[model samples]
Target: MAPVPVAEGIFTWPSDEPQLIGSRCTSCQIVTFPVQASCPRCASTKMEAHLLARRGRLWAWTTQEFPPPSPPYAGPTGDAFVPFGVGYVELGGEVRVETRLTVADPEALTEGMEMELVLVPFRADEDGDEVMTFAFRPAD
Candidate 1:
């Protein structure tokens, strides 16, 4: 089964080094991921699509030892619970994203470590097709 993106219009697909397609406020210089419809600070509608830096620095990180409440998190739970890393990654002074970290081992991460954007398997849909999502990992 083909891997499907978690959502559309977030990142370029089928890429070795993909960039997060975000939005930039024309009124101000603020940038946001997931392409905000309007600037959060200024509430201006003059937002434009902007490609984010693929590489970033790990600002901070932590691990999820248990499954999140199932209503929002559609991934596996209970026995299938897999500990994962969650963190903030700053993209070249553009923006900081709170996202899933590809590295599960906390010991492998460090403050200001170089990180690169990547696609990783998230979950399987009802049809058993793999659902993929963007993540960050130690840069090569």
Candidate 2:
């Protein structure tokens, strides 16, 4: 299990939900994932942060066999193959999010599979308050 930020304001979690603070351009009516303070296309700075929908369609995915370095990620430390998945999630309106997948088994995942987002606890310190994160789950 691991947590990583795939884009600005877009964080991916092990079993957690994937959330991307997003912005919808009022002028062009285009929604962008990983919220932008200013529109990259039209240079409009009138952007608002919006919570994206939990459900997304599988765009792509992959696995990681090598352990990620410390500092940013604090997950299992081993050489064993850790099968992971990530891809673009189409949320309609031309809005797509890059995030990880939550499948029972990595091998069972496929393109165009429906996915649902879930907010989950990542780690807890000595104080016992769980530091939370987000990821995507297969939609039921």
Candidate 3:
């Protein structure tokens, strides 16, 4: 089956180097992820699609020890669930993006460590197609 993105418009897909799709305010130059209609700083409506940096520094991190609550959480559960890492990565010193980490060990992750964007398997769709999602991993 074909692979598909977890959601639409979150990041560029079907590319060798995928980038997160964000918005930049033409008024204040403030950047936001997931694309915003208006600027948060000056409240300007002049926002444009901005492709965020693919590499960044890990600002902070934590482990998802338990499965997230249902209704919105659609991944594995019970014995099938695995603990994973989640963190905020500051990209190009412009914006901090909350993302899943490829590394899950707390002893391995450190603040200010270099991280690069990657695509990982998120879940399977109803038709059994693999769903892909964006994540960050330690840069060599």
What is the C-alpha local distance difference test score of each model? 0.90, 0.65, 0.95
Looking at model 3, the pairs that clash are none
Candidate with the greatest TM-score versus the true structure:
3
Q: Where in model 3 is the C-alpha error above 4 Å?
A: none
Off by over 4 Å in 1: none
| lDDT tens digits, residue span 1-140, model 1 | 99888899899886777888989999997999889899999999999999999888999899888899979989989898888899999997989988899888978989999999889899999988999998898999
Q: State the local distance difference test value for candidate 2.
A: 0.65
Model 3 residue 87 lDDT score: 100
Predicted candidate 2 versus true structure: per-residue lDDT over 1-140, tens digit per residue? 33333333654334244555678887776688777778878888888766677677878677555666776766445654344556677775367787656553666788888888766544554565555545677888
lDDT score of model 1?
A: 0.90
Candidate ranking (lDDT, best to worst): 3, 1, 2
Please report the TM-score between candidate 2 and the true structure: 0.71
Worst 10 residues of 1 by lDDT: 11-20
Clashing pairs in 2: 16-134, 16-135, 17-118, 17-134, 17-135, 18-135
Model 3 Cα lDDT, one tens digit per residue, 19-104: 99999999899999989999889999999999999999999999999999986899988998888999999998899999999999
- Compared with the true structure, model 1 gives a TM-score of 0.95
TM-score of each: 0.95, 0.71, 0.98
Separately for all candidates shown, the number of backbone clashes (residues 3 or more apart, or on different chains) is: 0, 6, 0
